[model samples]
Target chain A: EPEVTQTPSHQVTQMGQEVILRCVPISNHLYFYWYRQILGQKVEFLVSFYNNEISEKSEIFDDQFSVERPDGSNFTLKIRSTKLEDSAMYFCASSELLAGSGELFFGEGSRLTVL
Target chain B: GQQVMQIPQYQHVQEGEDFTTYCNSSTTLSNIQWYKQRPGGHPVFLIQLVKSGEVKKQKRLTFQFGEAKKNSSLHITATQTTDVGTYFCAGRVSSSNTGKLIFGQGTTLQVKP
Candidate 1:
């Protein structure tokens, strides 16, 4: 089956450094999302993207965070100046229908470690 | 803010035993979804419930949505060692169209052979 793919399975960065995680959603999917999970914690929604713009975002998605569909197939999340608390597994997901209206296919996730 | 809560943070069962996980939402939900994540793996979609008091089954697994649409449950009959994983329930509030899902902490199940 077609699946969403994420780059950089693991990343380690110093606090205050910038980091970018990339994802290639399923070719036919129109809605893209970014979610994060702290160790042993619930999955947290960060942002949702559609039509080349952000459809919605959560409080956790603050000024430090941004998402972009830089190309036809690439969706990227950039964190400016990472903090220790930013360490988590970041997941990229996509769906053919509207966000919650349909099932989401998630990538294996990019584990970010901030020191 | 809408929230989903799951009971029994962890469960340990012997092979062939039954297992069930319950999920409750702080607000009525438009829909609820279930996912399973194996150790060190990503969450995989298991199923979605969209109607009140709906029930669905897949092989040895069964799922139910409460009449009020605010709660749900997943039950597995005659569990096997392959059932080891964390089950999560995610809910979407009826009032929002943002498509954001509030996920529960999840119930981690360990099936022993």
Candidate 2:
């Protein structure tokens, strides 16, 4: 089956550095999302994208964070200035239908470590 | 703001034992979805419960949604070592179609052979 794929399974960067996490959501899926999970913490929503624009975002998705679908297949999340608290496993997900339909498929995740 | 909490942060059981995890949401949910993450792996979709008092089973695993749509549970009967993973219950409000998920803290299960 097709699945979401993320690049750079592990990323290490110094504080204040810019970092871009890339993902390729499953083809044919219209809805894409980003979620983060701190070590031993709940998964937190970051942002949701549809129709080439952000549909919703969480408070955690602040000015420093941005997402874009550069093309038909690649979805990217960029942090302008990374903070230590930004270290976590970032997951990319996609759903064939609506979010409430509940069949979101998640990527393996990119482990970001900001020092 | 909405929050989803799960009970028993960790569970260790012998192979063939039964296991269960409970999830509660601070607010009403239009639907609830379950995911399982194996050691050092990503979360994989398991099932979704949409109706109040809904119950669905997949072999040894059973899932139920609360009558008030504020709680959910995952029960695994005769669990094997492969069942050792973290289970998360994610809640979603139908009012929002952005596909964002409010996930529970998750219950990590360890099954010993």
Highest lDDT scorer: 1
Winner by TM-score: 1
Residue A20 of model 2 has an lDDT of: 96
lDDT of 1 by residue, B28-100 (tens): 9999999999999999999999999999999999999999999999999999999999999999899877688
Which digits, one per residue and each the tens of the lDDT, describe model 2 over residues B14-94? Answer: 999999999998888999999999988999999999999999999999999999999999999998998988999999975
lDDT of 2 at A13: 100
> How many pairs of residues in model 1 come into backbone collision?
0
Q: In model 2, what lDDT does residue B39 have?
A: 84
Model 1: residue B34 alpha-carbon error in angstroms: 0.5
Looking at candidate 2 chain A, the ten consecutive residues that score lowest on lDDT are A96-105
Given candidate 1, what's the lDDT at residue B56? 96
RMSD values for the candidates in order, in angstroms, are 0.7, 0.9
lDDT of 2 by residue, A15-80 (tens): 999999999998999999999999877888999999999999999999999999997899999999
Residue A16 in model 1: shift from native, Å? 0.3
The TM-scores, chain A only, for the candidates as listed are 0.98, 0.98
